[model samples]
Structures are given as structure tokens and as C-alpha cells.
Target: MDGLRLENEIEGEKTILMLKERRPIRHIVNIPKTRNTFCKGTKCRKHTPHKVTQYKAGKASLFAQGKRRYDRKQSGYGGQTKPVFHKKAKTTKKIVLRLECTVCKYKMQLPLKRCKHFELGGDKKTKGAALVF
Candidate 1:
């Protein structure tokens, strides 16, 4: 607290609304990820050779410490048990488009339309659905 400045302050009430963990990892190049370079065993603290594992679509990550940095729960001493974000967020791709309809040969367009045969954005009933989006 002497030299460090806390940019964002967390209130106890806000924890209920924002239980999910979120990280401000915008780009990869910004991260200080150690590659396959191993510190010399005699001099290095952890003389393990860490391979340059590219971050997949949030898959089974190898970096255990890196993952925990994204989650922080402060409650009564240890704080209340926080909800896991894995249940909420799905496997979303920034570039790739996922179709709700696997059978339909139609493509999900920019301006998603309500097609009787295809579901551009996954709607229960296609009736009266004229591109609600």
C-alpha cells in the first residue's frame, strides 16, 4: 500500500453481481510468457524448461499460476466461495462463426436473418422471427 496504487476498488456488494472472474488480457504480445528457454540448473530457481505453449481457446491450460491471476475473491478472511465462470461462458471464437443449425447448409450472415430452416443465432421457434437482431 505504500508504493502500489490500487486502480480499481472492489466493494463487497459488487461481488454478488460480478461473481465471474475477468482478466484484462487484450493481446498476447503484452504478456510476459516465458518460452522454451530454461534457466541454467545451477543458477536458476526453477530450472525447468517451459515450452512456448500458445494459448488455445481457453483449453486445459498448462500455466496454473497464470490462470489464477484472472481470479480474485476477497470475503470474510478467505471470502465466500466464488462462482466459477466456466458454467457461463461458452466456447466462443473471436473470428470463427458457429451455426446453431448443424443440418442446414445455410451460412450465418452478417445481418442474421430468421430462416424457417436455419437458426442464425439459435431461437427456439422460427415463427414471426424476422431478423430480430
Candidate 2:
């Protein structure tokens, strides 16, 4: 014996309506501040505390081989040497976590699932209350 559950068709889709004040449901999609996982470094081969951080790409060097080649090709004439990519397919980049072992200071990257929005160490969401943005 619980709340009343009724099924009704609306807009060609069957929806279930529950009339009761029950426990709120939440969807957890955020990674916590810290995590304890296995470290594959030479110093620590066991599980250790790891500091989680978002992975970011480093600045591209100007003296790279590819850059040098491209510069050489576009030095004199010829408008636009290589083809510039314009058709981007993906809307959001995949999130990557940088896990650093506190014991040995070893760092490794872990890729996460694709999501439209991702927050690291953000505030937890509570049911029935408006999000604080």
C-alpha cells in the first residue's frame, strides 16, 4: 500500500503519474574532489590516494616539426597552403581526468564519457529545489 499510480496516454506517449510525497530522486553525474585508485607507478603499485584534476592541453610549440614545415610551405606564394578544417562534427569535447598519485607524484590521464555539461567538484544537486547554477 503506497501512493496511487495511474497510467494515462498523452501525446501518444504513455506517462505514469504518481500522487504521493516520496523520497526525492537525484541523478549524480559529477566526479568528486578526490579519489582512491590503483597507482601503476614504479614507486607505488598498490592503491593510493590520488588527486583528481581536469586535463588541459598544453600550448603548442612554435618550433615544432609540423609548424616548421607548414611555415616553409606558406613562405613565398600560394594562398593557404594546407586545408583548414571547418566542418567540426562534435559539439563538446570529451572530459579527461588527470589522476596524480600522492605517494609517488605519478600522473596518468583517464577519459570519461561524453556529456553536454561537466563540473568538477561542483555543488551537489538536491531534489525539489532549484539549481543554483
Model 2, position 104, has a per-residue lDDT of: 97
Error of 1 at 105 (Å): 23
lDDT of 2: 0.86
| Residue pairs with backbone overlap in model 2 | none
Candidate 1: regions farther than 4 A off:
1-65, 70-77, 80-133
Cα misplacement distance, residue 66 of candidate 1 (Å): 4.0
Candidate lDDT (C-alpha), each: 0.35, 0.86
Candidate 1: Cα lDDT at 105: 23
- lDDT, candidate 1, at 80: 49
Whole-model lDDT for model 1 versus the true structure? 0.35
Task: Find the candidate with the highest TM-score and give its number.
Answer: 2
Each candidate structure's TM-score, on Cα atoms with residue i matched to residue i, is: 0.16, 0.72
RMSD of 1: 21.4
lDDT tens digits, residue span 85-104, model 2: 99999666778999999999
User: Candidate 1: minimum summed lDDT over ten consecutive residues — where?
Assistant: 105-114
Residue-level lDDT tens digits of model 1 in 1-133: 1233324447743322223444343222221223223333344434343322222254667457745654443423664465656666533323322222222222221222222232222334557777765
